[model samples]
Target: MNFKPRFVALLVTLAVLVGAAGTYIGMQYFGDPGGQKQTANADQGAQNFGSLSEEEQKEFLDKVGNTDLKKVEQAYSVIKDNYVKDVDQQELVEGAIQGMLDKLDDPYSVYMDKDTMKQFNQTIESSFEGIGAEVSMVDDKVTVVAPIKGSPAEKAGIKPNDQILKVDGKSVEGMELYDAVLKIRGKKGSEVKLQIDRPGSEDLLTVNITRDDIPLETVYSDTKTVDGKKVGVLEITSFSEKTSDEFKKALTKLEDDGIEGLVIDVRGNPGGLLQDVEEILKQFIPKDKPIVQVEDRNGEKSRYFSELEKKKDYPITVLMDEGSASASEILASAMKEAGGYDLVGTKSFGKGTVQQAIPMGDGSTIKLTLFKWLTPDGNWIHKKGIQPTVKVKQPDYFYTNPVEIKVALKYDDTSDKVKNLQTMLEGLGYDPGRKDGYFDKETVDAVKAFQKDAGLEVTGEIDEKTGGKIEEKVVKEVRDDKNDLQMKKALDALFK
Candidate 1:
């Protein structure tokens, strides 16, 4: 997955900067309560504010208390005298208001004028009507880092690493990130054109995507075997609603399969709901075990406890990387502190700040940093991420191939099973170029060449409809090789 800064990091920075600005402004305006003339000055300022033109009003508001009335008047006079183009007074006033808020430097806090503000509120409720994809600026261009799983963008074939150059035929150059988001999001059923550049493709790709309601799924799981141990792999993609439920199902599958161990893959997962994470903890922890604690502004600490009565007995290993953030770190920390689990992979993307999405009366919302969270043992995994118990880097041999193979036939390159087949192929003797894990032309050629040598149809593709044909031939060739030891172990465990 593409790595980027976590959203929570930006939120915390914005909150601190904006809060300081608010404090400063409060001190300046309400510093002296004893001066009756202050009231008179405020009323006079309000009156003058109503009389000025848009640009003049903005200039007046900005210099209101900093300078005397004469200076304010002079500033407005200059703007009116030297203006080159006609400007809307209301827009100018709004822009000045926004400028003041922007000075706070909080990405989450801003004056969203009535229109944009409404859409902001919808995002917090998670009920936005638009193409569901998280976008950001990378290398000065708008890029789709990841389409929310099962969202319209994902359903429309948008993938991570796709560069979005244009939206609705308009270039995204010079457009603010917020503005670009607003333009891409719209009422449901509406259509938007995205000019995308996919990785390894030479030309730009155009995709017409329709907007739809995007409901986030925080948890997803599937059962698989590793070394014949009936290992269950549950991927908690994010911490959102239904996460605990999904986790329960994963545990149920393990129980049904009578698996001896499990692996939870949390790589590339940016966090969401905190309550969901706490609930998930209950499954692995015993009742009354402390999961985490949060201390609020008044120095009061709230402890979250696990409600699980009995813990799963299977040995568990957690897979994490830099993309595992926030609530993900919370869960990983708890599992490590509680013991019985081994963490494998890189350090987590640390983001311990908790943000409250406070909705304005209008449609917009403010994600305010409420409190910083800590593990039950009081370990602060904020900027410094959690260290894994067994850190293992992905093997480089998975990428580089020593030789290239040619084929006598063509195969379906778009089948979903191609990736798994490529992995299986690499496990055998046939070299299929780099395993970026796609059945590209190289993989297809290798497969066709293998098929021709095995006295099978020269098609390079493996289809479920035609399976067991290639597997029977391919598996027989290297069935007794030392390299096939892992596959034998997996098959033996399944049979046993």
Candidate 2:
């Protein structure tokens, strides 16, 4: 025998012997060594390769790489033995799967456990009772941005910008947002007490509300003018059911008003009902134009188009702010793409992902992001906001001064003006009860009575004309006291 050939044969036999021993050891310690036998068998069924083809090698490697049932069983056994706490084997397995999914770090990608999955399914098919408020955590506090109109939250007098301090006597501090929401929401007729704090108030307010079914309505419109232009201002708060019908009515009113322009205010509106947005856009966009495209998993794509014909003839301006989001952005983008519309105010709050409310078997649902939306112009406004074409800021002092006078009253305060007015009214036989700075009912009554007696319009309004007469009377009476600073200041302010 050739020593080289003999030595090679011995080495090959030794390698096979070692593999056999290792397999036996794995089988003895672990469970079934043949657990993956079917997989290995199927992989080995592949035939011939061209000069040890890459495909053949891959198939071979895949078959033997992790196919040893014994080794896999041993690995699981090791984990069970080494795990520090008593673990539910099923839970461990599910947790592992969930952990893998969590690596995606997507808020939408979730593993619904048995109970959660059931709840999610149920929420989709039927209405579940809950407090009618869309609540969110802002700056670590539960804040109510808006109470769903006509919902229990609104009925209970919950207003936007209210900070919830406690829910049902439990402090909400450091609680998870969803957990807080769940606690607040319950079956119909269930009552929950909320401790809230509102701005410009000194005391914490408590409100008790009952859970109820909340139906979200989408489109709302009213005829109003902007800049004396007599334009129809359609405020589409959200694209919901009946939105298209509402839009049609608004359009008809605009036509009847001889409106030449339109201002669609989408400020502070969250999106709803994709179909409603599509239908509303029909009033502005031409039919057959692509409105939006949703690209989902598996590389599948779906496009929504405008089926609109009778386009409204008007100069369109969309008013938007940071609070305007979702369906609002869709409508705004569509109008922009259709051409001849101006976007005003601040950039929008960009939420460009599409979420589907998937109902579990239980009475809860999970809103998961199934796809992302892109504007017809190919703009992705997910985290980045939509920019306005013409930015208009509200003046800070707009509400500081009196815009209108619905009622008028007289002052009898100790302030020099009040004292002078009182003394003058008394001299004129229009006795204002006291010279106090307070504007009491007696003072108002006396002013009205004086207006009536003087044959002046009994509006009880202390306007420039009435004030002038009162000042003249006071000056004539007080001319001897010329050095009065208070009287001079009061007169200066009133005259100016």
Candidate 3:
């Protein structure tokens, strides 16, 4: 993750798309200014970036072709001088930058104006207040990549891939990624209402989340006992500045305590510094192979390797899911490929390119995609995520939707809401009989049993209150450690 800066910038992005994702970032630099004939030493571990020497500046400008800039200037003049009304010249300039980025069609590549750039830098240097979730621009929609573990977004049931349609009653359709994120982020204690469009659901959901000071600490350590053996579980919520060091301490303590195996859980980690993941990978991966490979625009590659001569003696397993992304993916891929370990859970959130934030000489910044990161085995898992060796999906109730009660759901009623309630009932051991959205006689009996056990009215019909209680219980069950089948699978995989 350490880039030898070549004066001109191109780099491994240590930061998130900022406002879109709560993941933090730091500036990194590397470059190949083009114009010159770039040679490929594909096997080389280090690269001399296409010589950014003084003599090449003219060649670089010549290669850029002045015709495009001339055309842009022509358009600016036509609009500014002959338009219907006066225009903010600065706005026009900003629009030109944004327009060029839009043509690239890369959501990660964005323009951060003066104020936005300041806030973005501040977020990385310290902390900010928000709903604690990582979002991305997918198919032109602002979609939730993953909610931060234990954040308000996760507490409010904001799942990955939820397309945010509005924020605080305002439609964000066609809004820029930063603008949309700004609307969502606010001071702690302020409330933000989100209208979400989730896949596989019939109705759009409105989630009310109160913003809070998103936690900066990224690592959590604990122990799990399985089959009379102590196993250490390190859950990385994200890979921030202190993550790698924190991870080292946790691992050391676990080792000192004499653990049989380890579970590296990156289930809901959106992502952070690439360097942090690389630093962690060195602990487990042998030095024989490169930890990861970086491919630049000219198709030349730079291989990065760890100096470790040996791997850990104890068995290791990586736990991941759809919410796992970027640096999280890097760690999981390295463990599976180089360390010869097992991975448990569903596929990962694929984001393979690296970015660099370049100052535009005016307090503005252009966060540009610079390189594509390949796995140790040379796999580019861009849109295609890494598949787990052992895929374990959570219980059906965990993915169920909240019931929207317009009227009481009686035995004759049949709807998606009823089906969700049935799944919840079944998950909690209430024999709902059928789960196909049909509220049959068996479902009624199941509801009655649940109601009686909970000391409710036992009406045999699902009212608003009843549905709310059922949803609450379902969420609780989903959170319970005993019900975490994926963790169990990951731990078992370690032994296997």
Candidate 4:
């Protein structure tokens, strides 16, 4: 969270590209040789620009020859006099600036008009009003980076990588990122209809989200008894300004409750401040231990360290998924390298670069890439994400379409359906040995054991009735409440 005074911009995952120089730039009157006076609304002092200081103005005029200056004046006069309607000087200036930035072709570099700049600052301060979802411009389209957990956006099923096609029935194609965000975000309790194009689906889905002030609880923890041993479950929804503080408090509460092990979940986290993550890692890592190394553009490296006096001794398991990115990956990598924690879940969303925001005097800001982050061991995971120590991909049926229970499955049946059955059986306490598609003798015995427990026909083969029962149990154990098979596996690895 420490920012250099000259570069007073925030590190943000959902930030838009803003274009800015060091000072205000107001337009001059068309035909004054001495220098035209700027006459914008006085109320927009910060938003409006005035003529440069005398020395700077002389320097600029000298740099651009008088011929080019005359040409610019002629163009301005043409637009002012020949245009059918009255032209707003501010709009013309802002438009010209936007055109220049568009040529950069970098989605992260943007031009923020006064209004957009206000919203951008509000968001950076973390007190904005809108549907809680992190968004970024990807492939010239407005895409959802990640929906905040338990927010209206997430509840409405706005998923990561969903292409937003329209807002309130208006096409947003080719619109500025800030403009698209402004259209999508609205007053609390007001509804904004988003046309989403999700991957794997041909049809465009309309998701209506009722905007609200996002809930700011970034950390949650509780203790659960697993095989008579107390295990702490610490789930971080996302990193925020106060995330490290919240994490410390959660860990203190868990310690007071006497936990024997820990499970850290960062499943849908998009990421936030780099300092917050470093502080969180400090709690479990020993003093002076390297957490991560940041290499600047010139290849000069700065290593961040843990400030803790002693490392925590309990076994820790980190849970991650495709949505976990940036600081989440930073914490995961540090914990694995320095604390020797076990990582369980799918590959992470790899985003390893660092950005620094530079605020301009004209109420605009620019976020520029400044560094590339690496793991404690110097491994770079930019486009290539970190693989988990124990790869446990969450079953799709837990949140999506139900697994089809087709023909009866028994010993010698070799198909993906049998694999699903075996995985479910193992999840429900039956020892199927392996989850490979082949239904061997071990699978048949596990099926018979499940039948006997469920009070069904105790046949070794899975019948139609048995398949339905298995599906029901799988739904109950995995879906009816929430997906916890990954968590169960983590606990099994830690305790049993």
Candidate 5:
């Protein structure tokens, strides 16, 4: 299927960073608090057409006298009447629509035909049938925001900010976020090949992932003893329909269990519904300040507040990383600025605008970026993400690139792949003798040691299979609690 015509552009994804849109009605705003605040006029970035609210409609109509669409109509008529080759009128019209959105330079404002919207609704409405990862258009390239936890994307070694070069050999260079997702989406058990440009790799990485039903559990909770105090850990994977209720239940249980503090972990979380995250924030943020402030195009700010009269008796710490975005960012900022809680971890995937899903009543939809949501302190954290109060990054091994082996790597070989292999070996407790990209005899011995322990033939050589195994072990080590320096710091921050 030529997905280009179906979906024009998108900023976020629920394929796990597509926009966090719920069921679309006439027009519903969804971003930070939920939905958009359309522009007052073209000057405010609202198009000459679409209006999600009555105010936007009135403003658009008021500008109707000043703006001339006769030129647009005349151009369309000229093209349809005089163009030598016949053009699909629908295609031309859609192109014009997308062209306008593209010129806005905002990927969040997008148009989706019925077919694309159906597929999109199917994914976000329920289980997604695709490579489990959240992606966004960053600097016009389709970048992986974060792989779904324990999904095909994560299993294939996909990481946050991975710029997707191709899908099944087709370059997605200029495709919209959703259009790229259409290329990545497939049936369960079917493999999808992705070529990615990761941050630190010397070359592009090629990964093959079998599509599957992505994880939707949303909330995970447990308790641990830190400083002789029971510290409750509530890990929010995503803010879906049921996520707020799940969080409430988890928090209730933790509070009932006599926890002295809480660690709210939103690490690697892409984003989700606004209501879900807002609800979760209300539980922590008191009435002293708004949990979030929504700024419209007219420089008007509307603050949303929780009715809670007091803060939580116990201290709270919010754990966030670069992959934590959208609604995750909402929670992180609110906790930091409004709730006065400590934020621990690296920076966030900055997305400060909210999008509105406007229904055409034909199952087609347009997601338009309209509002810029500010942090509680009126700080616009759009491109500038919310910085951590106590920044704690993971180990160097956690950020290593995949070891793509085109040829078997034997002793005396030297390349970037060899350097990656050495890092993994060292992370796994084997001594490779050198961190430089050189495969010495000690590196060969390290591979042999890993091979023997992994039950593979002790061939002292790193093959494609060996590389895959090494990547898998490295991912496991990254997920290990003992290696999670951020979580340790978060737990420790609660006490201070």
Candidate 6:
């Protein structure tokens, strides 16, 4: 499935960066927020012609002959006369509009129906009632990009890259992402069953999740005493309308706690509002510093700048992974350039384009990619994601299956799975040295510490009991920080 940024797009995995000057195409004056007739006029011209009688059709055609609309009229008349069944004129018109945009082959560009438009707006506003998860159309399959931390999907063991084989026992093969999401999300306390396919495993996994009200609290932070140094960890889940305010509150509280360093975690963060990111960056970046640069189709360039003069001088690190994209990338790139922060974790999702959600006069909306963004250093990391200064990749099973170690992992063992154990250890407050995949002396020591704490035989080897304990620790810490490996590295770098 395609990796979608969390905020700028749809709720079930789509994100857009809305920063630079947006050219609004169609602005509707007034309508009910949840009204169905909001998109009625988008294709009304063709629909009106389709409803006319043979003589009236010709007259209408003649009336529009002097304009470019005659071409559309001719096509509609042909379809009306030759189609086997009586077609829904409005549907035909909407389909034509969608087809036109489809020809562009841009995933970010989409024609949203009234309901979709409403839902998309709700997501941007940062409040929704659903089973929190980011999903996207990956290879035409409904795939799970990442479950929101503390969300029902995450609690149900839904992992990144898990394909949706069925929803509520209904096969979702070849289903559009937006449509599938609509079916999956419902009122609070409602149940949604999903059949999952993790890439490396052959057996399908089923998860029954209960939907709830996913809050708009995008930023979370707390101070931790690491190696006698005051360290603040700020977790950014998604950049939403409320993200900037939340970030400020978290930062202020951390400052009050007298933190000397900071870590910003954006792992599995699909990204949110671009302006929200820009506003958050203002607190860190110096006034007048370039935050991000955007280039339009005509080669016109615009740079967004920070507005705050007061800046924090603490050493900072950012945590990221393949699930981070768009606004998250913007924040990571800008901070790395302007604030001299080091990024730890694997490369990001690499979405560098900007999209605008232009509301049509009716209820529908056309979300189109209007420009490409560049990092403060003028780097375009589209497709090729932003690589971390310190590259750390978690074990595959860390995402697919956190529990149930298939093999006995002892000291000197080397594999991606070992790295997974190390990551979990670090999250549970044990220092596993480094997430280097190789089981070194530090890893053994950390494992032994964990075993002793769990009332096990204090064995350095990761046996079944040891592995189960590690999984429990990891599951608990995951909601606190999006990615355990990245967060551990950030803390280690600051304290050690």
- List the global CA lDDT of all models: 0.54, 0.53, 0.76, 0.67, 0.74, 0.68
Tens digits of per-residue lDDT, candidate 4, 1-496, equal 1223231221110111111210000100011001111222422122211244566435444544456545545766677678999998666656655554576665544555566556544554455567877766778888766777767787666676788899989999988777777687777899998888877544476777888777667898877777898999989976666888999988998998889999999887877677778888888877666898998766778998866887677778899887787788998998888878888888987777765444444565444445689999888897687888989977654433123444676778887667767777877789888877799988889989999999999988887788778767875765333466678778777754
TM-scores, each model vs. reference: 0.53, 0.50, 0.89, 0.69, 0.86, 0.71
lDDT tens readout by residue for model 1, 334-363? 888864466777787656666444333233
**Candidates arranged by TM-score, highest first:** 3, 5, 6, 4, 1, 2
- Per-residue CA lDDT of model 6 for 9-31, tens digit only, reads 22111111000001000111011
Which sections of candidate 5 miss by over 4 Å? 1-62, 65-67, 410-412, 455-460
C-alpha displacement of 235 in model 5, angstroms? 1.2
Tell me the TM-score of model 5.
0.86
Cα lDDT tens digits, model 5, 254-281, are 9999999999999888777777888888
lDDT of 2: 0.53
Model 4 earns a TM-score of 0.69
User: Candidate 1 — what's its lDDT?
Assistant: 0.54
What ranges in model 2 sit over 4 Å off? 1-104, 108-131, 135-166, 169-178, 186-215, 226-230, 245-259, 287-289, 296-303, 309-311, 357-367, 393-496
Clashes, model 3: 2
Two-way TM-score contest, 1 vs 3, winner: 3
How many steric clashes does model 6 contain? 10
- Give the lowest summed-lDDT range of ten residues in model 5: 10-19
Ranking by lDDT: 3, 5, 6, 4, 1, 2
Candidate 4: which pairs clash? 9-357, 17-110, 18-110, 19-110
75, model 6: CA deviation in Å? 1.8
What is the alpha-carbon lDDT for the whole of candidate 3? 0.76
lDDT per residue, candidate 3, 261-377, as tens digits? 999999977777778888899988889987888898778899889999998888889999998888888888889888899999999988888766566545666666778889999
